[model samples]
Target: MDNEGVFVTKRSIKWLATLALSASLPAAASTCGDQGVWLQVLGSGGPEVGDQRASSSYLIWHNGKARILVDFGSGALLRFEEAQAKIEDLSAVAFTHFHVDHSGDFPALVKASFFSPRTAPLPVLGPSGNHLLPSTEQFVTRLFNESSGVWPYLSDHLSGNGAYPLIPHELASNSTQPTTVWEGVSAKLSGVGVNHGPLPAIAWRADIGGKSIVFSGDMSGRSGTLEKLAQHADLLVAHNAVPESARGVARRLHMPPSVIGTIANAASVTEVVISHRMLRTLERKEETERFIRDSYKGLVHFANDLNCFAVP
Candidate 1:
């Protein structure tokens, strides 16, 4: 419950390319005779400026390949490679929010991918923007396409040679129920908006094979849609950024361990993985676990960078 393996072989790489090209996406990568999906904690820390750990990020590996990336935070690209996750195997990325700690390493990832031999397009899903922030389309364009973006060289990545296309998807920030975002050979993705103060954030759920993993992202305890999206999930990846009951302004945007525990228990999740680890939460692991254990009896694991959890 507190531990996380990653073994890659030549056969796996061959299968990865074959799968990536043949199907263009996973149809039931989890449902086949294969084992199940694997989730890796690519980043374990939050926005602490210059922390040693990576920021909030994760990987959803199916059929022995890292196919879906949950976030692209600072230092995550390094961890992603450290875990031996091939850049070419990634099919899509879901950004819970645009917070630097959650989506900061995107440019680095793209830069790294340029060195790989990938030909397929990479799909990106993000929350709809409002007056305060840019929508997913605007974000991607401004970051990689528009002339005003930081990286002017990436403007034509979506349709140019020697570049894997970046397909951007902007989800409605008001969605409460799960809406299918992407479907692959073995994976089906869904997104549902959750309250996160003024930030337009959303939680993501992926069903691979037959098992399910729900990512709570960052949420204020008020969203009941999280429970619905997480129902009967095999694993619930909840952020451990706040305390048991959270205090002050943090309470308005982050869910405490108790609230997270209740959501997992109510949804009858088989396991819970606490990530997006912050200094306060990391220092008070025992206290945080105690509050969570009070409501959820299932296994609870505090995540660390590169920890891989098998989604069974």
Candidate 2:
């Protein structure tokens, strides 16, 4: 292996050119079936601007209806509409972190939901905060707190005076074990703390209709907490933000392909979906897939905006 831990071969040059060309093409139309649980990629790109794709967001569909939302990054609102999802149909919304790319469009979603028919309190769950980050409740309060919030007009949502109140649930950030955040007749949600450098972050798992799907968020994989939450999951949505050669702060914030592979392998997940694509990792798709395959023998899919996968 090279210094960056990337496997270097004589065919690397030829492969790079081919993979880059493929990466530039528009993603093919992929839609999930209508009969069971489905995962839809709302925003496939990361925090970058040039990718044309939106930032990180995801939707979980159960029996043709959107049941849960995993994140609401930039441009995700538009994608949600395009996917024919209804805010009223969502049982809860879980965030991986409070990063702009992961939660920037939250207020926008709340604003849009004003027109929806949902009357029940919406459950919003996220990680507990440390000194560097605000807790989930604090994050929501700072956004909609009546007196000092950025959107004071919409503060009624927090005060139970709006169309529907928002109930914020904060998962402990120091715990590696999964903690249940929300539970319903057919759906149960859990989360665990993850390593995202100094930022407070967590990964989410949803169990619905006898199927399990885990979102890895933007973890660096150093905490080793994801394995327990993702164990034996039907689908794992892992972030492929940086290449194996990435180092310094980039390495500290996001997991490389090798770590993703190891986690999926160790967790024994059925399939892996890699999202949070950035320009840096887009052209290096082949190399990333190669490293992930080095450890994980299961299915690996590179995510695209609007791409859908049915849980089987």
Candidate 3:
């Protein structure tokens, strides 16, 4: 049977009915509400911008303090500012990969750091480098080093006299399993490898104040890596770039709705937030939700720009 036909099957129909009923209720705000650990969707769109979803960036707040900024994609800086996010409050920045759509805004963010009064060097984390792709350390250095790069204005600030500094940290390529890459402010950042061409991809799992949330950074389908890292997370933010009907091209770099559902089901995450929507998925939101609901029995939410999810 074709994918569309399967979605209309009795089981899927019942699931959709349940989803319709559940959608009427207010969604859970957060996993740690009193502790103030919350998630803000800076940009919900993918590489393409149709409905103004801002690529794939998220801001995580711990105890009303900005603990981490995850994946600063293109135009994310604008979205962050629009959301009233404090760039200086960030303890660390974690990049899932070096894709233009995901990490393109890093240089701009670094330049903006100069205007802030940050005394400590900002820690930036990402995968190890290869000949083609720069490691997290090299990526940051190339941007601010005195020799060459785009932001020469940052040279003085990066050097002496209480300038804004960036401390680069590279996550070992293909680490055996998920491990802590950065930890502070009652939060821990850990990651697992994901398939996104030869560029190398990663997914982050953060534990903030005893609550956990996972972000799947553009994986190739529903792999065990995602399930293992996201296992039992309070919220699993999965990418929904293509519909189940999409094939070939999308299967290589992105996951369809069904794939996301299966992974969320396997991980047993309490809630599944669909993000990174491309032009196609943005126009067909209901279709994507129905496709995912067919296999996954959990709360499925379609995230939008600036939408905040409060952690319990």
CA displacement after TM-score superposition, residue 279 of candidate 2 (Å): 0.6
**35-74: candidate 3 lDDT, tens digit per residue:** 5678877878778745676778988877766678889998
**lDDT of all predictions, in order shown?**
0.80, 0.88, 0.75
- Answer with 1 or 2, whichever has the higher lDDT: 2
Model 2, span 1-312: residue lDDT tens: 001112335656744543454454434445656778989999999999899899999999998889999989999999999998999999999999898999999999999998999898899999999888889999999999999998999999988888899999989887889989899879999999999999999999999989999999998999999999999999999999999999999999999999999999999999888899999998887689788977986667788899887775
Alpha-carbon runs more than 4 Å astray in model 1: 1-35, 49-51, 159-162
Q: Candidate 3 overall Cα lDDT vs. reference? A: 0.75
Best by lDDT: 2
My TM-score estimates for the predictions, one after another, are: 0.87, 0.91, 0.88
Candidate 2: stretches off by over 4 Å: 1-30
Q: Can you tell me which runs of candidate 3 are displaced by over 4 Å?
A: 1-13, 27-35, 156-162
Instruction: lDDT for model 2, please.
Output: 0.88
State the TM-score for model 1. Answer: 0.87
Report model 2's TM-score to 2 decimal places: 0.91
